[model samples]
Structures are given as structure tokens and as C-alpha cells.
Target chain A: MFDFNIVTQWLDTLLMSFLPAWATVLIECVLVALAIITLYAVFAIVMIYMERKVCAWFQCRLGPDRVGPWGLLQVFCDVLKMMTKEIVNFRKTDQLLHRAAPFLVVTASMVTFSCLPWNKGAQIIDFNVGVFFFLAISSIGVVGILLAGWSANNKYSLIGAMRSGAQIISYELSIGMIMLAMICLTGTMSFSEICQQQENLGWNIIRGHVPAVLCFILYLIAGNAECNRGPFDMPEAESELTAGYHTEYSGMDFGYYYLAEYMNLFICAGIAATIFLGGWAAPLIPDWEMWNEIMLYVPGFVWFLMKVFFVLMLLLWERWTFPRLRIDQLLNLEWKYMLPMTMALLVVMAICVSFGFIWN
Target chain B: MENKSYFSGLFSGIKSLCTGLKVTGRELFTKKVTERYPENRKNNTVSERFRGVLAMPHNENNEHKCVGCGICEMNCPNGTIKVESEMVEVDGKKKKQLVRYIYDHGSCIYCMLCTRSCPHGAITFQPEFESAVFSREALVKQLNKPGSKCAEKPAPARPAVAPKPATTADVTTPVAPAAPESDDKVAKLVAAAKKAADNAAAAKVAAEEAAAKAAAAPEDADLKAAADEAAAKAAKLAIVADNVAKKVAEAQA
Candidate 1:
């Protein structure tokens, strides 16, 4: 779909001739890593600005409007500010863990982006069990949050870390079950294969019918909670925790956590878009090959970005509109409300699949 | 019953949330109520009486109403508005003209006391509200133009003392009737009057001699009656002379 593969192939042949087999592989991995990091930085700038603009619009305000034309340069100016700010040292704290925590967080989010498909066959990795790997890898961000809180040696950070741990663990189960429902329908553990299944069998949200719709809603709610955003963002709740686990962090140290949170949001939105909205696949308009050709002229990456940003806007709308959930209420929402419903929907879908009622 | 209530409560929560989204969604499509700030300055307006900063307004001819009485300087609570006036030759007169109306906008509190107390209404707070600037010195500006006086006024146009010059010149220059400064001229005129009185007495005696000769030669009753009428006229003239001396003495007092 893009010239990225052509460049990758050229680099692979060039690296292979100059170095040993393993060294060439290592060099390729380094290149991909560099590309993902660059994407992460760009994604953070765009997402932060979008979030601020969305929040401002909901409240009838013009957000960040003085930096450049319509405040387009605000993110760059803020990043510069964060980079130049001094990192403050904590008294009587675990220095090593504190230093390693932000790196761990940013790394986890960057790794998650590797599994997401930007266009057809343009993903960084196409490993089998990509969904399982993504689920497992994304949960590791909470460990960084916990480390940052514990190593800071502050009471609020510790409480926030504990809350985040509980919140992520609670939401992860429902998200897992919802994904399981969608996964059974696709009958695969690989992302590319799963995306291809949707393309062949009409997108899962339509293929799985009502069950897919239920899963989509439940998945978004759980995903929102999983990222600790909006009503579910109790751990780093501004009113309660004064900014949660990274309270003691200053400068780029705090900025790393911020970047991680936004990256997590984008990946979640992208995953939602990929699994449900047909990753980079144009909307089907049957019996019109000319129309299909016209749509493809717009490119798959633009469609992918449109769907991703649409999902991101949905998340932002909920964040700005909903009030913060209390810690007990957050857990109650998962265990009492979402879990039982997810289980019932799974049983109903299993029976439908066995009976051969499910169709594209 | 309990299970139904739980389901109902969840439904109600979702419904309320949907309601909130509806309001926000409706507003999203509606025209934004927020100003784009610097872009919106063209449309917005300050209040009619909003005193943003002190300013001296000039007419099209580059003239203002300030006569440089320093009244606004005295009326300002913070002494923010200073009037620096140099005496200039306007119309061949040493008139106190306004060289500079120093309006220190940085220190102004906008109390409206200076505008209210300005007698000629020369200085006022204009409705232009975008007064913020980078430096304090940029706010200090000379308001009135140096070359011209007020359009609605002549030179030295202090309202309190404007009419005094013309009226006082008319009253003082016309007469020394009640002034002691003209005493020397009055005394020289009185000496001249006494000499004129002696000459008149000598002329009257000569005329009386000529009249006696004519009367004695004619020897007629009609001529004797004419002499009696002349004696009566002389008596009336003597009465007028007594009143003039009395009036002159009263003026000297």
C-alpha cells in the first residue's frame, strides 16, 4: 500500500551484504525501533493537541490559541518546555527504579504500536498470537506506574499506584473476555489473518451481528478504564491524587508518563478501529467496481487514520462529558455490571456459532 | 425485584449520560459562543463609560480644548495625567499654550475624576480598549499636538477667566472717572479751566461795556428789557457752574 516495504527491502539487501546474518537482523530491528519511536513522538503531539481542542470545544472555549496560527505550535512549545525543565531528585527514595520507570512505560506503549496495522501489510510486526502479545505487553505499563509510585516514596503516588493496579487488573478481565468473543468469531490469534477474515467476512462488528456490537461497546468501556482515562482515571485523579503516580516527577520525567498515557490511548483507539471498523478497508459499496476504485484512490492509510481519529474522538467526548468515578464505583462497574453481561453474551454467541446461525 | 431494579438503575444511568452527550453534541454544531480573542477585537466594544486609559482627543485641525490650567493634574487622584504647557506667542499675545498633554496610562487607575473635573472637556477616556503593551514607557505618550490650540476655543481659553480680558479692557480704558491713577491729568485740566474762566470774565466785562454804550445811545424801553433777559440767562449759567464743581469734587473722592 505504501513505499515503506520497498525501502525496507532495499535496506535489508544492503544490510545483508555489509554484515553477518544476525547483525543484519539486529540492524533491521534497530531501524524499525527508530521508526516506531519517531511515530510515537509525532502521535503524542497530534493526540495532545486533539485532546485539548476536544475538551475546549465541549466547554465552549478556544484552547491553546496563542502559540502559532490557531495554536498549532502549542505542542512543540510545550515539548520544548518539558525538555528544558530540570528533573528534581527525591529525598530518601529508590533512585534506580525511579529513573527506569518512565523508560519502561514509554517502551511498553511503543511496543504496542508495533502490532497495530496502519495500512494493508504495513505493520512493524506480523507475529502469530499478535492479539495475545499486545494484551500481555500493554498490561506491563501498570508495572511502570507502580514502580514510579513506590520509588517516589510519596503517599499520594503510592495510593495512586495501588489504585491504578486495581483499576487495570479489574478492566483487563472484561476487555479480555470481549476480545475472546471477537477472537472466536475470527477463529485466529494473528492480527493480519484476523484483519483478512474481517475483510472477507464483512467487518466483525457486522459479521458477529448483535454480539459484535455488545463486544464493541464493552470493549471500549473496558479499554477506556484500562487506560485510566476519564471517569475511570481514578489513580491519577487530579482532584484526589494531585496527578497520581508521577506527582514527584518533574520535567521530561513527568512528560514521559504523559507521552505513555496518550500513546496507550492512540493504540487502544487504533485497535478498536482495526478489529471492528475494518482496518484500512474501505466501506463496501456493492456492484460498483468504479466506486470501489474511486474509494481506493483515497488510499488505505487515510481511511485507517480517519477511523482511528473517529474512535479517539469518541473516547475524548466520553472523557470530557463524564464525571470521575470513585475507586469502589470503578471496580463495581467492572465486576457487577460489565463482567456478567460479557459472560452472558459469550454464551449466547457460542450457541449461535455451534448452530451455524452466524454469517457474514 | 432486586435484579429488575439493578437493570433499571443501569438503564437510567446510561440515559442520563446520553442526555449529557446530547447537550454537548447540540452545542458542537451550534455556532461557537467563544471569541477568537485578537481576531474578535473588530466586533467587540468597551462600555460607553469604560475608562480604559486617559487620552486627549484632538479635532481634525489637530487642536484640543486644554488651556493648560493644570486642573486635570490637580483632579487626578494618582497624579497620572500631567499637562506640560509652554507659554507661546499666539496671535501676538503671550498665551499659555499646551505643548504636551502627558498622559501616563501605565499609572492610571481609571477613576474618571480627571475627566469629570476637566472644565473644557478636552481630555476623555476613548472607547479603544486594546491598551496592553510590552513596556511601561510605551504607554506614556504626548496627547495634544504642539502647533495648534483648541478648535472650539481661542488662545488662553480658561473658562473661569475667558471673558475677563475683553470686558475689563472696555471698562478700564474708556474712563478715569473712578481711578486715582489719572490725578495728574485731572489737575492739569483744572488749571487750564481756571485760565479759561478768567478770560471769560474779561470778555463779559467788555461785552457789558459795549452793551451799556448801545443802551445809553438808544434810550428805548425795549433795549432795557433785553438787558434784564441777559441778566436772567447769566444767573442760570452761574447755577450750572456751581453743579460742575460739585460733580468734579465727588469724582476725585
Candidate 2:
């Protein structure tokens, strides 16, 4: 981002000199939004490729190898294929919502990125109620999924959307609880502030002890559930729902659901890194100035990516390894098991925070 | 149910999931079951008993064991095999020889009926199952060479019965005459037949005398004498054939 930083600074100075301040800010905001969209597309492609390779390895099979080396270009080729395919609509459907559903889903997922902390000062916006906004905006994607299913007038899609709505709403409780646990530990809602606080302390996982680790585990399961992936992927259960909400979708509309799904997974993993695993923060060896200085040679963005990839690997590992949980089982697990467990962990964590046991 | 508490049940569920994950994690190191087909074709070998296409077993001399008996063709349920034979001159004698052995591979359902029904152990199932063809015509193959005849021939025992002509006549007479005719016609027929019979008898007696003489004579001279006697016998048979033809013509008139 050297040139990107330089070019953006140059544009800002140029705009400030010539254009009205409001117009300059407005155009700059649009450019940043556009950049976020591009990031979503690129991140979706990378995650999809990684998923294919990792899932293949888990099953003792070779993944795509025909395109670029180790099939790195497979996603690009798939994108081309999806773009060229005709978007087929069904006989009886609400054309407006059916067509609008995917973009809505994608936008909901993309908006959450404005509050994400990639590195120190690398966030798009530092909202005072950032964590709340993240939770609220991300959950809005369920509406898109519901509309996708309901608008298509497909029974399977309707069931899928309904499941997605239920699953996301249920899992949202546990995910928010885990975030609250982290928030309690960090004492901030802004992503960069939370991350900076983690840098001050070691990490929430270390300071909050066992409860923090439990919170991490609970978050992993619920976040995966929220994204509607394997194991927790009952809504899009291919055997059950065909494609869940996106069954009637074709061509790029179908592609959009996939993009949103995988990109959502990426953010979930990124957030996990940010909250529990200490996003972009290397472990500190205190009183060793030489080693610390050498460690600084590694960029924070790379550390962020490495942590994200680790989380992704965990997601992939769990997906390939486990059979899908039944609908009743999924609800029961969340309501009966994860909900109570996460709530208990949060109370434990709150005690730890109050007693000054968690390092500031 | 074990009546387990919520915490205990949750722990057990996660434990089971972890166990399954462990299995897949171990499998991550295992070799894959799929072989890229076209690239790995050279490494493939079908089993010995694999029934692919019908073929005839040929010796090192390029001579196949199929005798054009049409037994395989008859036994084929789908009419896939077609055997056609025609009379051909071989070794100066007219013999029924194999003209074509058309095998329609497209119609063959890989039923080993044709291979099993062959009496001479002639048909075999060649294990070459990459048998896709561009056109149906490409699958219809001729399995034998042109004018291919059976290797085994039976021709030498006709004269051995001359010593027991009474029995031989009983077996041979009715085979030629289908009706009772007028006395003159019967006499002519008998005369013509008797002349033919006398010629065969004389030839037999001469053959026996020549055999005895050859046994007593020197080796080189005996072979020359045998060759001369064979020519004389062949000529006498030609004369008999002409007299029989005249007798048949007279009867028709």
C-alpha cells in the first residue's frame, strides 16, 4: 500500500486545494467504499481457493491443479464462468427482492469492514459504538438471506432462509456475548482501541485465562454458525435445503451469495483474531530491545493475514472433519449448550475483570 | 439415555466431533484414491478374467483356431457374431472355408456366451476395454483372414472299405439311387455302377500289390512306384466320374 498511501495523500492535498471540503470528503468516501468492495471480491476469491485446497487435503484428495500452479487461478476462471452464465429467474417470484437480495447480503457483510482493524490506525472508521454497530450491521445480512429465500417462492429456499434467520439470530447471542467478554477485557468498543489495549496487555486470551479461551471457543462455533458454514450450515444444507436461501438464484446472483458467505467467514475469522487471538500483535519478549526491534521488521498486515489464515485453517479443518449438525441439534446446541456456556464464561470473565485479575 | 447433565453431554458431543476430526486429520497424509485417467492410462492393467471384446486365439503361425462352424454365431443372444463360409479350392480339393468372421462389438453386452460356446477353444475375451469408437461401423470387425480353412483334414479312409464291398455297397447304394427304374434303365445303371465298381476294385488290388512290392523293393524305387500307382488311381477315378455322368444323362432322357 506504499503507492496507495502516497497517491491517496496526493489526491487529498490536490482535492483540498481545488474542490470544496465537503465534495472532497464525499468523493474520498466513495473511493474508500469502492476499495472496500474490491477488497471483498479479492478476499472472497482467496478464501474460496484456500478452502478448496484445505478441504481436499483433509479428505486425502488433490484439489484443482489445471489452471495456474496448484489451481490458484481456479477461482478467477470460476468467476468468469459465473459472470457469463445467464441469471435464470423462476416462474413465480417477487422479481424486485429476488434480484435485490444478493447485493443486500453482500452490502451487509461489506459494511462490517468499516469498523474492522487490520493494523494500528488501519481501520476505515473508529465508531464509539463500533462493536455494537458491527454486531447490528452484520446481523442485518439475515434479512437479505430471508428475502432471498422468500422472494424466490421456492419451498426449499423458504425453509433455508427461515433456518438461516433462526440460526443467525440464535448464534448472534453467543457471538455478541463473546465480543462482550473481549470488550470487558479490553474496556473499549472501537476496534483499533481494543487492539491497542491488547498490545498494552499481552492479549485477552492470556489475561482473562481459561474463561477467555472458553469465550474464544464459543465464538469460533457461533461465528461459524452465523456465517452458515459446514457443521453449523443447516440453512444451506445441500442435502436438506439444496442451497437454502439461494436455491432459486442463478449465475452471478448465486455467485453473490457465495461471495458474501465466504467473505463473511473471512471477517468472522479476522474478528476472532482481533478479539481473542490478538490481531496483528506478535508475542512480546520484554526487556529484549534487539529482538523486539528485529521483530518490528515483519509488517503488522502480514501478522494480521497469518492469524486470519490460521483461523481459516481451523474453520476448514472443522468443516471437513464433522458431519452437519441436525436442525434440532443445532438449535439445541446453541440454546441448551453454547448459550449457557458462553453466559457462564462471561460472568467468570467479568469477575476476573472486576478483581483486577485480567491484565490491563 | 445415561441421564447426563448438560455440561457433561456438551463435553461428550465436542469430544465426538474432535475424534472425527482426528480421523480426517490423519487421512490428510494418506494417498488419494483417484488416478487422473488419461494421464495414468499407461499404468493401468486390467485383471486376467476381464471380459472386454471377443477375439480368436491365434498361434505363433498366425493361424486361428476358429473353424467357421457358426456355433458362436448361433449361441450369441444379440446376433453380434456373423460367420460366413464358402467352398474354396485348397490343396486341389473343394473345401468349405471361412470367408468372414464379422464381430459387431457395439451389440456385444460383454456376455461371454460366444467365447464359452466355441468347441475348438477358438474364441477368447481380449482385455482391451478402452473400446470407444467414433462410428458404429468402426466397431464391426472381421475376425478372420480371407479363405482361411480348418487346419485338420479327413480324406484318406475311402478305399479301406474295398475289402468289404457288400457292407460298403449297402451304405453307398441307396445314397446315389432314389427310385426303382425300368429293367433296361436298371441294367444300364447297374452296368455303369459295376464298371465303376470293377475299376475301384482293380485299383484297390493294384494298390495292395504295389504296397507289398514297395515293402520288398529298395527304398528309392519304392517311392517312385508309389507315386506312379497314385496317379493311376486318380486317373481311374476320373474315368468313373465320366461314366457316372453319362448314366445320369441317359436316365434323364
Candidate 3:
């Protein structure tokens, strides 16, 4: 026998024992950040190509087949082209905020990944208030957008940024309320604790009855809006405002903002997977302990990636199929429709929890 | 009408979401229609009849049929044709021959007129239309082959008819001959007079027809009705003059 398990367990024990707590935390943070950034970059590149191909397929045209194999490297080539292009900065822009905005947005997006519980033992920071921390940190990116818009001295950019700020803030309420309902059911704010709670109580999605499903759906919509994704992407309305808030950005700054948008998408997908899909918990089967033991051999990070990619695909599918909403329509959806409906769902969920309908 | 309750409305939203998801789910598995072009171009070839570029055809003798006849040049609505004739020695006699027949493919409308108008039967449609080129000069085709002149064909000769022999009975009949000669002279004079009269009548008729055509040209409504009836009997070809010009330019290119 090779005795692989013994060696692995020994190595794990040695590392856990020998490493200083602070150093471990620092190393883990750097590793996770690097992983998220890498994943985000790859996902953005792939998604851009996928979107173009999907559009071409729908429209009955062959898309970008000349660049690389099946045009997979077309986006990379386009990125290179963009990199070589001159960065045109208008003379009237506020030199400081206009330049700093993209970095701020990207930084905020990167930080949100810190709280995402990829799997049972795989997370950058498994803090007690992980959900709240993610929400708080993610919201700050909107300020950067607003600042960029205001500093650009462009009327369209300013309007777009203002709209985005209002929209994200408005949608955050419904999203926060829905998450609160999940928190109430789970009885913990820590992401890993939430995942463990679901495993113990058989997925909050199914355990908390019908209303929980409604809350989950509500969370998805709110999250989509928060990311300024389709149906709610009025702020970056390409048709009307060119590129909206980032209309003035060029070169690497523009790329950073673009990267940040996708990173936000990645974070949103991670949150959805963690909160509702039971993290990396395998479906219960007979000989559950044995199955859990087998599952442990498969790294938790891989399962987390699978779940996130699935959610991301779903988001992209929604983006491509649906027509974008008008600014007025977006506001109406939030204040008039989503807000009241989510409130009702929350009330129903709370009632269901009180009546012992949630956990048996 | 009874108003729907808030709970029912909420249920409707859920139903719509499910419907949306179902639609997306169906599309996710549907065969992707991405045709990787360049790889698939050989299989998905365009039809031969597809109008791409215009090419001019040379005759069997490699001589152009243009004959310096500016019919195509005149007929082209878009000034795409440029024909230049030069005086050259043909069979030891100076003759005006078509030197340059330059057709701009870029400006050609592909109307096919030039091929139709080539009286010498030199120009024809070649059907090799893929004329994409980098320079403007490449688009202008000089149709005249180097060191070649228009080949002239000789006219065919007419055959002679045999005369009938005069009989002795015809010679003996003096009275008949005198009467017949006078009659023949009178008849000849009469015939000449009749011929002159007929010529005058024909001239009048032709003049009347020309006047009628000129007058009727403006009043197209009545003229079209009459023309249609006449055309039905004569089987006149409905040739669009502009389209013919375009085709000629395309062929020349």
C-alpha cells in the first residue's frame, strides 16, 4: 500500500501545527485573493467570447472564427488590441477621481471575494458576520462609480452613475431583507456556519417550506440588480449612454472597471451558492458518513467553483435572452414591485419559521 | 369583475419566473448553430448565379466585337464605359478601329447592355465576376487585346438567274409586237409613274407614322395601350436599356 492518506494527514497536521496563526491567515488571504482574481480574469475572458458566440448563433451568423480555434482566443486578441490603443483623457476631467475610479471599483470587487464561503473548509475569511461584511464591502464600489461619473464632467455619465447609485441602494434593501430571512432561518451570520446549519437541517431552501423558495428567488433578482446585470443594467445602457459611468475611462483603467464588473458577478454567484445551494454539501444518500468521507477527498474549492460557474452561466443566459429594462422600469421594479413582494415573502417566511413549518 | 388578491399576484410572479426558467433551460440544450466560418465555407458555397464581379468575353479569334460603336458608352446610365477609337491600317486602308474599351468594374451596375450591343459579336458575358482588387486601376479593364484589330468578315455574293428563249411566233407577230412594245413602254412609264406615286405615298405614310410616334410619346397612357396590342402581335422584347448597359460594363470588366 502507498499509505497516501497517512502522508497527507501528517503533512496537514504539520502545517497546521508549525505555521503561526497570523502568517497562516495572511498566506490564506493572499492565496484566495490570487485565486479569485485569476478565476475572475478567466471567467471574464470566456464569458465575453461566449456572449459574442451566443449572439452570433442566435442571429444566424458565424462569429469570430479567424482568430483562434473556434475563436476562443478572439477576446484575448481584442484585449491586446485595447492595451495597445492610446488612452484618450479629456482635458476637462477631474484628474484625481477620474483616474482612481476604476481601481476603486476593482478593489471593492476583489475585497468582496474575501467573505465568500466557497466550501466547508475553503474560504478566504470565515468570519462570524461574513454575509454583512460582503454586502457592506460590495456596496462601496457604487460610490467609486458615482465619483467617476461626477468627475468625468459628462452629463450622460453623471446621470448614469447617479441612476446606478440609486438603483443599487434601492435594491440593496430588498436583498438585505431577504438575506435577513435566510439569517433568521440559519441562526448564524458566518458563511461556514450557514453551510453547516443547512447540512444539519437539510438545506434551508427545502427546510423552510415554500416561502423560503420565494425569498431565494427574490435574493437572485436583487443580486442581479445589485451587479447591474441585464434587465437591471440601465446604468451602463450601451444604447443610450455609450458605456455610462465608464464612458471616459480608457486603457488599463477601462480594463480594470470591466474586470471589476465580472468580479462582482463572481461574488454574487458565490453568495447565491453559499446561502441557498448548501455550499459544497453533497446530496444526502444512504451510508451518509461514508459518502461524506469520500466527498472530503475531493477538494472543497473545486465544488465551490462548480457551483459558482453554474450560477454564472444562469446569469449570462438571463442577460442574453431578456431585453434590458428602462430606468423608470428598473425603479418601478424595485420600489413598486420587488420591495413589496419581498416584504410579503419575508413575512410569510417569518410566519412559517414561527409555526415550526421550517425545521421539523 | 372581481379583483385578484395580492397572494394570487405573488403566485403569478412565481409562475412567470418558472416559465422564464423553463424557456432558458430549453434553449441551453438546443443545438448551437455556430458555423465556424472559413472551415465551413467550402461546404456552404454561394450559387454560380450570384452576381459578384463582371467580366468581358473575347471572340474565338481573340478580337473584341466593340467596333468602336458607342452604343454601350451612350447607353450606360452611370458613365462607367470609356471607349476610345483609333485610326489604324486594315488591309492597306485606314479604318477607325476600337483601340481601348475600358470598363470600370467599381462603377458598373451590371446591366448587361454592352454584350447585347456588340454588333460584331466580339463581346460576351464571361461569368467570372470575383473581381475584388486593391487598386482602382485594377478595376478598369482594357478590353482590346494587344496588337489585335477587329477581324472583318467578307460579304457573300449573289447567284445569277437564266433567261427564257424568244419564240419564232413571237417574232412573226409584228402587230402584236408593235402594240406590245407601245403597251410595254406605256406600261413601263405607267409603272414608273406608279412607282413614283407609291414612293410619294410611302414617304407620306412614313412621315405620318413618325409624327404619330412623336405625338404619342408624350401621351404614354394611350400609346402604351396601343403599343401593348401591337407588341403582342410583333412579340417585341421588353429590354431595359439601363440594365443592358450595366451588364455590358460588368462583362467588359
lDDT for B204 in candidate 1 is 43
**Of the candidates shown, which would achieve the greatest lDDT relative to the real structure?**
2
Scoring only the A-chain of each prediction against the true A-chain gives TM-scores of 0.95, 0.95, 0.87
TM-score of every model? 0.67, 0.72, 0.67
Regions of model 2 farther than 4 Å from truth: A1-19, A89-92, A287-290, A356-360, B1-8, B40-103, B110-129, B142-253
Model 1: how far residue B202 lies from native, Å = 86
The count of residue-pair clashes in candidate 1 stands at: 0
Model 1, A331-359: lDDT tens per residue? 99999999998988888778777776686
Better of 1 and 2 by lDDT: 2
Instruction: Estimate every model's Cα lDDT from 0 to 1.
Output: 0.80, 0.80, 0.71
The number of the candidate with the highest TM-score is 2
Candidate 3 structure quality by residue, lDDT tens digits, A93-188 = 998889888878988887886677655565666788888887888888998999999999998899889989999999999988888888877878
Give all candidate RMSDs, comma-separated: 22.3, 16.1, 12.3
Report fnat in order of the candidates.
0.44, 0.79, 0.21
Tens-digit lDDT track of model 2 for A1-360: 111245567889999998999999999999988878787788899999989988888888888877888798999999999999999977789999999999899888888865667766567866778888899999889999999989999899999999999999999999988888878888888777777677667777887888998888788888889999988889988977787888998899999899988989999999988887777676556688887677666766777788889888888888788888899989998998888888888888889889888654
- Candidate 3: where is the Cα deviation over 4 Å? A1-65, A78-91, A286-297, B1-37, B47-49, B55-76, B81-103, B109-130, B141-253
